[model samples]
Target chain A: MAEQDLTSSSILIAQAQTDTGNSEAQQPGNAAGTNDAVEEQVVQEANDAAQGITVVVEGSEVVAADPAVELHAETQGAYTEQEKSVFPPFDSSTFGPQLFWLALTFGVLYLLMSKIALPRIGEILEVRRDRIEGDLAEAERLRQKTDQAIEAFEAELAEARAKSHGIADETRAKIKSEMDAKRRDVEADLAKQVATAEARILKTKTDALANVDQIAAETAVAVVGKLAGKVSIKDARVAVSDVVKG
Target chain B: MAGTDPISQFKVKTLFSFGTIGADENGANGVDLVFTNSALFMVLTVGLIATYLILSTRGRGLVPSRLQLVSEMSYEFIANMVRSSAGTEGMKFFPLVFSLFSFILIANMWGMFPYFFAVTSQIIITAALALLVMAVVIIYGVWKNGFGFLKLFVPSGIPLPILFIVVPIEVLSFLSRPLSLSLRLFGNILAGHIVLKVFAGFIVSLSALGALGMFGSILPFVMAVALTGLEFLVSALQAFVFAILTCIYLNDAIHPGH
Candidate 1:
């Protein structure tokens, strides 16, 4: 659609050029022939009508600028008389300067590109490439270092776990041995107390038995002496012996 | 005080006249060396290109600034175009392609400004540049491939009887390359500018009628505005087309078979 628009517009321009060319060729003949007389007559009539209007306005106390009107008309006339060629670029007179300048400017630009701008840009691109490569190499080295550090950390963690297990085992054995020694001492003290308690009981019983025998012997002798003075110690002693044997 | 004629805008007026120089009796100063408006714009184009490419990269930072990025992008754009069209061996002609691209691109852009003359609109200038490209192609093709370059005018796989008719047609088409290349750029620019001027003329002429005419002038004014925008695109597109064509032609130089 856009391309069609361009082609149609270009066709319009070509038509306009041809029209201008024909008009230019006819311009001299029109001026020299009767057409100029008709144009002058029309201009005269228009001038008269403008003047009549101005005079009427002046009678109403309004002033018109006559000089400005004349100037405008003169300029319009000059514009109409200007060259009618549509394509100025085809003029041969201007070609030399246009070509000369084109060559000069284009040559200078070519030199600037090949000599300076392009090479400088190439250098910058090269520097960027090298910088990026260096950064990548450094990153790889740091990554390797990180990997080694992680491996070492893991190894130390494993050793620490083994040492903790050994320490715990040692602590449990020491606690058990100390508790066994305390128990043995307590048992020995208890056994000694029990032996002393038995010895006290045996002593008390022996004392009481000896007291009973003496009392009994004394009572028997007193009774025999009081009742039958003449009854002998032999009889009392035999009585006491028989009672003890029973 | 003549009224402005839009067509006069394209005229190349003499800025300084050196009044000819050399051995011709009819020549005023013997040479027709006159600095012109076209010359001024051409210089301006070159200056702008230099500023964009050279000064922009003066810092050459690892992280590019906007200007530097633009310069680099332009460089790579042309470089890659050449590489793709002409192959890696075409890189040797990188400077030529680069120069042509930047010059035309800047010239086209600078012409977009109001009251500025568009150099590429001239058939003479574009024709000269196109002829230069053709010259390079012929010289390089003959030098590198010798008589083998003539094979470009003779297609392969054609029967012997048909070769006679096909060969002349091929040569004629080959010779028309520069003409087409130059005319395409020139016509696009010339027609666009002319359309813009006509629309602008409508606005001026319409607005002179009265209050109603002033209001009616808005239509042409809008059209002129729209055309200005379109011209901007046309300028850039034409420059790109011209550059790519140059690369394709140069490719024929480097490898001249079908």
Candidate 2:
């Protein structure tokens, strides 16, 4: 954009220069002729379709300042004004004493900035940008790795919880079954002991009744022998029989 | 500090004479084609700018060293100037504008040292610079719009009746380019140096009084010190303004009459 501006302005100055000069004053027309020549070249390339270079040489004065005289007069007057601004105006003509050195300074400066200063700056910015981008990428990669590790850890925790719960349930069932079996064995042993005791009591009662019957028969025989004298043996035998039946 | 009389002490005999071609009867005189104090220092400034910039930029690393950092800062300063004033679309002119800014700034600042002659204090130097800028402005303006650039002299919005009066003023203003541009630079630089010189003169003349006068010399010395710092800022500002104005003038060329 800027280059175009410079080019266009130079062209404007060239046009103004041409307009200011008569045909005879075109000898030192360095910038104007070049500009016109460039326009002509553009036209010649386009051939018939192109607009020929129309030198707006004879336009109204309101349009363009004659570059040749206008630039010279303005610069000259500016130089005088500048001198008056600081020192006594001195000689009005001393305005351009250092013109060559000024040009030299500008030329030298332009080269340094363009060639040296600008590139260094560009390089620094490029590096900084690249560094930031690289750091970001590295951080992202680390974050992704950490996320994967965390996911694995969470999965392992859930599996461990399930395994622990399963073990607890199995242990609870095993303890309950063992306690029930032990209770059943204890109840059966207690019932058998009660049955044996009942059988022993019934046997003792029957033996006592048999022994009493035998003893009564013996006593009745002895009494009859004694009462045979009194003819009582039949009575004694009947009494014994009665006792055994009771 | 080069002796107390920096400007006067560096004076050299006039080498030769020249003329302004056709603009004035005498082109340019005082010193012809040889190296004088101003020329030597101007060359020194260029050399310093070149050597330092080259050394700073030789390796071109992603991370800059101290030297490289200075170089980069200078670059960013000019780049931003072009970008902000001229717009992003005009950033391509960064190299040119940035170079001009740095060169002028460095030259102006270096000239501020005691006993150092400010090159910008010379009118011819400033005029040449102004001419260069004017040349750029006019050439670009005509190139973009051809005859339409003539409209720049006659602005819009004022009543038609008032144009007759406004036209001459506008034309004179437009024609005052080299003067305004050059004088702005020359006047500022010259004024600063003259002020510094006058104060130094006071300090010197006052010291002859006595112990009381010696004590009083503090004020002038302080003022000179303060002025020196101010001069530094002014030099940088002037250079920046010069470059910015050039960009503005170029803008006129791109969009003529605006």
Best candidate (score: lDDT): 1
Residue B202, candidate 1: alpha-carbon lDDT: 81
TM-score of chain A of each: 0.36, 0.40
Model 2 has a DockQ score of: 0.17
TM-score of chain B of each: 0.95, 0.84
For all predicted structures, in order, the TM-scores are 0.64, 0.57
Model 2 over residues A69-159: C-alpha lDDT tens digits?
3344334433211122223222333334345665676676776666656666686688888999999999999999999999999999999
TM-score of 2: 0.57
Candidate 1 root-mean-square deviation in Å: 17.0
Say which docking band candidate 1 falls in. Answer: acceptable
| Chain B TM-score of predicted candidate 1 relative to the true chain B | 0.95
| Candidate 1 lDDT over residue span A152-227, tens digit each | 9999998899888888988888888888788777877777777777777777777767556556656677887777
Candidate 1 matches the true fold with a TM-score of 0.64
Per-candidate clash tally:
7, 16
Tell me model 2's lDDT, rounded to 2 decimals.
0.67
